[model samples]
Target: MYYIHLEGVPMQCVLVWLWHIVRSLTSIEKILLRDRPQTLYDLSSKGTVPVLQLADGSVIDESVDIMKWALKRNDPEHWYKENFDHQDGLVNKNDEIFKKRLDRYKYHVRFPERSYQDHRADVSEILNEYNSLLEPGPYMFGKDICFTDIALMPFVRQCAHVDLEWFNSSFPELGAWLDRLKESELFISIMVKYPIWNESESGQYVTWE
Candidate 1:
């Protein structure tokens, strides 16, 4: 069976959503960051959530890597259809640039040196890039949801949540795109809350089938 250890957080949510969209049936174990189980430690010493344990016993811990693995197995919608370099470029920007800014903006207290507004300003150019990309169609790659859209939507959603008023006014296209992703079956299915896993219990795991 395909086994996944996840939390309800955005990165984990991305993996869950991708697996669901690809119809990758999996045994999902909900985890708590504060109270990670020994199994998690054994599987991934880094203790990262959204770790996927393949039936062969190999594991993939990175969220994006897990997405690639799932999609590579079956991409019915052709999320990676065309423009390989462009898709990789956008995904890279989201992960490398926007995500850092988003983290600082969302939890300004942790990054006390930079004001929350400063963090928001740092990602303005990236947001503008997304706005430009979406001008031709709703999805990032135009007319179809692709790797970049699913890869970056959660981070964008997090950013929009930071200052709803500013986000709506400053980036209307992005705000609408975020809304569309939030309302999709892919988002909704993966977002269902599950009780945190406990090793002491018997048959306590959940399966996303």
Candidate 2:
């Protein structure tokens, strides 16, 4: 979806799920493998990448809905639950605010006049809030490696790319979090490859164990 929006490819289906899976479980995933949906339940007028057609012929156009349908049927490693942050769910915080700041900062060029630094300052302030709540074990909280770690790592990855040397120098703890995610086979495998979603020659999915 990101690829399609970014590069403007006439997105077909899930030829690139972004996240890795050995096999397709939901019929939607499988159908996407063969071809992308053009008119999901006659909802093409709505417009979206994963307009999923259900067993009852109902269609869902949201990304989260599509993922829920596909993964609910097959989540052996519990990545979804872990990523969701059922307890306290600080990951939701990171996803909601941190990622938004990171997005603005990473794409500051679109905003013009304002530099990436302007947006990055907001991201930095949020990270500092996380840091304030942190206790050095490297997780958001004192010792629990919660969903916050998993949910927020991708934007951190993109931040690193924006300026690895600068990013590493500024936020050591955040860098460490990024390092942990990068070292994990789940993140690397799921993130490193994909059809780039027809956008920036990169995909927009992440999977984990």
Candidate 3:
């Protein structure tokens, strides 16, 4: 597990960590990306965090791909059941549309073309759609947590944290949904802090059994 820490919390890494907890995956080395280590470049020239290198030497780099891989191995919770096409569509919208607006909204200074409020409004459009979808209560697809919920939660959390007060007031359903996931045992367990991976020192090994 190669993960990036932002604002003292795992970003994309949350997806992999959540799946690890759900499936009880164990003995995985957790490498914290801090100063751009050479080992990271060696494994993946892309230098992106949340890179998973299996014992067989195969690498799973993308966060969504890693989630799918883990579910394929052991989905005791059956997170990847029917309605995969719908799930994939939602995930794609999150990764493609929501994520872009989130970055702009979160870092408005970098995106000068739009005012901070405008960027925030752009994000709200997507949030509004999700808020309606979640009106059935609890989760994206209703009742049980599914792959779509896990895939979108981290990004939604990021968006909410941008302006929490506004989020809480505006998207009541979505906000409550996010709060539930944040308070889950799985979310809290994966949030354990690890020392920055040092070239000379062994990285931390994470396991949940």
- Which candidate's TM-score is highest? 1
Backbone clashes, each candidate = 0, 5, 1
Q: Write the number of the candidate with greater TM-score, choosing between 1 and 3.
A: 1
RMSD of 2: 7.6
**Model 3 whole-model lDDT (C-alpha atoms):** 0.75
Query: Once model 2 is optimally superposed onto the true structure by TM-score, how far is the C-alpha of residue 119 displaced, in angstroms?
Result: 1.8
For model 3, the superposed segments whose C-alpha errors exceed 4 Å read: 1-34
User: What does candidate 2's lDDT look like per residue over 1-209, in tens digits?
Assistant: 12122112212123223343334333222123234444332454654455555545566665444445545655554445543544335555654677677778888988777776688787778766655554367666435544345445555677678889887787777777768756766554433222423322233433333
Q: All candidates' TM-scores?
A: 0.90, 0.57, 0.88
lDDT score, residue 154, model 3? 84
- Lowest summed lDDT window (length 10), candidate 2: 3-12
Clashing pairs in 2: 3-198, 3-199, 7-199, 12-36, 196-202
Residue 67 in candidate 2, Cα distance off native in Å: 6.2
Writing each residue's lDDT as its tens digit, candidate 3 over 53-169 gives: 775677767778878877786677778878999999999898888989999999999999989989989999999999999998789888998888888888899889888999999
Model 1 lDDT tens row, 59-159: 98888788877677767788876888998888877778778888787888999898867877887878888988888899888888888888888788777
TM-score of model 3 vs. true structure:
0.88
Clashes of 2: 5
Candidate lDDT (C-alpha), each: 0.76, 0.51, 0.75
